[model samples]
Target: MTAEIKKQKHVGRWVAVGIVGVIVLALLAAIGWYFVRVNPSVQQVETIETAFPEESLRPEAGEGDGQPVNVLLLGTDARGEGDSLLTDLGDRADTILVAHIPPDRESVQIMSIMRDSWVEIPGHGMAKVNSALAYGGVPLMVQVVEGIIDQRIDHVSIIDFAGFEGLTESMGGVTVNNDIAFSYHGYDYPQGEITIQGEEALIYVRARSPFSDGDYQRVHNQRAFLRGLMTQLMTRENLTNPNRMADILATISPHVATSDTFDLGTVASLGSQLAGIGNSNIQTFTMPTLGTGMEGSQSVVHVNWDGVEEIRAAFDEESMTTFEPPAER
Candidate 1:
C-alpha cells in the first residue's frame, strides 16, 4: 500500500473513534439532565416573611464562623387515597421535629415535638401545636414552634407520609429496631430489627392504637425509622451511586415542600455539613411534656413548664449534647 493511503486509513480510524466518544458523552449528559428534571419543584411559603422579626432569624451555615442550623421537619398524613405527595396547608402536621446541627457539624440532634401539645399558636389563641398549620400554614407552624422553643427556625421541610412509602420502597426497604412487639392493621411487627418497605413503612409510623401509650410509642417508632433511613441513605453504596440517590430523592421530592429560603443548593450544603455525623452521633428525644390530660373536650399533651427551662437553655446555647428529656411519667 502507498504511504498516503496508509496514513489516510489511520486518520480515518481515529476520526471514527472520536465521533463515538462524543456521542457517548452527549448521551451521558442527556441522562444526567433528565434526572435533574426529576427533582421536585420547590414550593415557596410567601407568608414566612411576615412570620417573625428579622432579628429572630438564625444565621445560615457558613455565615461568620458558622452557626447551628435548625430545620423544622414536618410529616403530614395523606389527605386521601390518590392524593398528591406534596401535602397542602389544609392538612394537619402529624409529626413535627426540629433537626439541629451544631456549628461543629460533628453531630445532629433531633427533637420531636408532640403534635397535640397544647400551646399558644400565634394569632390563633391556645390550641394544639399542629393546629398552627391549619390556621396560617407553614409560617404559623414555624411561629408556634419558635414561640415554644424560643429559638429561631432557619428552615423548614414538610413531607407527606406517602413520600415515606416511596422513599422506603426505592431504598429497597429499611430496618428499624422495634423495642416492643405489636400488631396493627393486619401487619405483625415483632420486637427486634424489622425490615419494612412501601405501605408497611407508612403503617409502621401511623400505628398508635396497639400501644397503651398511644402517640408516644408512635413518635418513638417514627424516630427509629428515620434514623434507620438516614443510616441506609448514607451508606457507601447509596451515596456513591448518583442514580440511586437521585431515585430516592425523586421519590420523596414531589411530596416535599420547603421554606422559600431552602433550595437544592441548601439541601446539598446541609447534607455536606451533616455528612460527618453518623447514626450513633445523632440523638433523638421527644420534647418534654406532662402526661396526657383533658383540655376542654380534647385530650392534649401539656407542656412541662419545669422542663422547658432546661430545653430552652440547651437551645439558646446550641448545646443539645448536654440536654436531656425529663424523666418519663
Candidate 2:
C-alpha cells in the first residue's frame, strides 16, 4: 500500500508549502514597494507652514482621543500680486469651513460659514465674520469661531489659491455638479456635471457674482466642490495607488499651512481611522442663516441663533447624525 505512495504524498505537501511561502513573500514585496514610492511624498506634508493661534486665546478642547475634534479651515486670497500668505495673515478669508470629526471617527462633517455673517468679533466689535482674520489674524478668527460654536477648535489651516490648484490637479481633477451655469473669469462653466482642475478649480469655487443669491449660492457651490474633492481623494484608485497619493500630497503640501499640533502624522492617523468611510459618510453643508440683511451701510448675513444652538447641542453630544442645515435660499 506502499512506500511509493507515501513518498509522493510528502513531495506534494512540500510543493504546497513552497507555493504558500512564495505568495507571502510576493505580498510583502508589493507592500514594501508601495510604501517606498509614496512615503517621501507624505513627508512633504510636514513641510506645509504651521501657524497656531496662541493657546491663551483658543477655547478649551476636551482631552483624550475619545472626545470630538473641530478644525478650522480658511482659504484666503492674500497671495495676489507678489504677496505671500505668511506675510498677509490678516487678509479677509473668502472660505471658512469648520471640519468636525466625532469621537467615533465614522464620518467627517464640513460646515461652511458665510463670509459676511454679522458676528461679534471680540475687540473689533460687530463686523463681518470674515473680517476676524483681517482684523486680528488667526487668533481673532479662532476666538470668533469658538464664540459662534461655543466649542474648542483643536486645529486650524489656511490655504490660498495655489493650494486649491494643487489639490484639484493632484487628484487629476474633481467633478462637481454645477447647479447654475455661469461664465466667470473668462471661463464659461456650463450647468451640470463638470470636472475642473488647476486654476479653473479655484475660479469655479470663487465665482459667486453671477448668481442672484450671491454668497448663499457661493457657499452651496463651495460645499459641493469640497464634497466632490473629498470623494475623489477617498476613491479606491487614489487610496490604493501610492504613486497617485504621493503626487497629490506633494502638490498640496507646499501651499498649505496648519496648526503646529496637526502635523502629517496626526493627519495620517485621521485618515487611517476613517479609512473605510465612503461618499455617503461625508457631509458638507452651510451653517443656517436668516438670509442676507442690511446692518447699517454694509450688507451682512444674519445668524440663525436657533440653528446655532442646535449645532452646539450636536457638538456637545458628539454626533451630527441629527444635524440639519437650513434650506438653500
Say which candidate scores most in TM-score. Answer: 2
Stretches off by above 4 angstroms in model 1 are: 1-63, 78-88, 318-326
Model 2 stretches with alpha carbons more than 4 Å out: 1-57, 80-83
Cα-based lDDT at residue 289, candidate 2 = 87
| Per-model tally of clashing residue pairs | 1, 0
What are the Cα lDDT values of the candidates? 0.74, 0.78
Q: Each model's RMSD to truth, in Å?
A: 6.8, 4.7
TM-score result, candidate 1: 0.79
Write the residue-wise lDDT of candidate 1 on 88-170 in tens digits.
54546778998877776766777888898898876678888888777876667777777667667888877777777888999
lDDT of predicted model 2: 0.78
Q: What TM-score, to 2 decimals, does candidate 2 have?
A: 0.82
Structural RMSD, model 1: 6.8
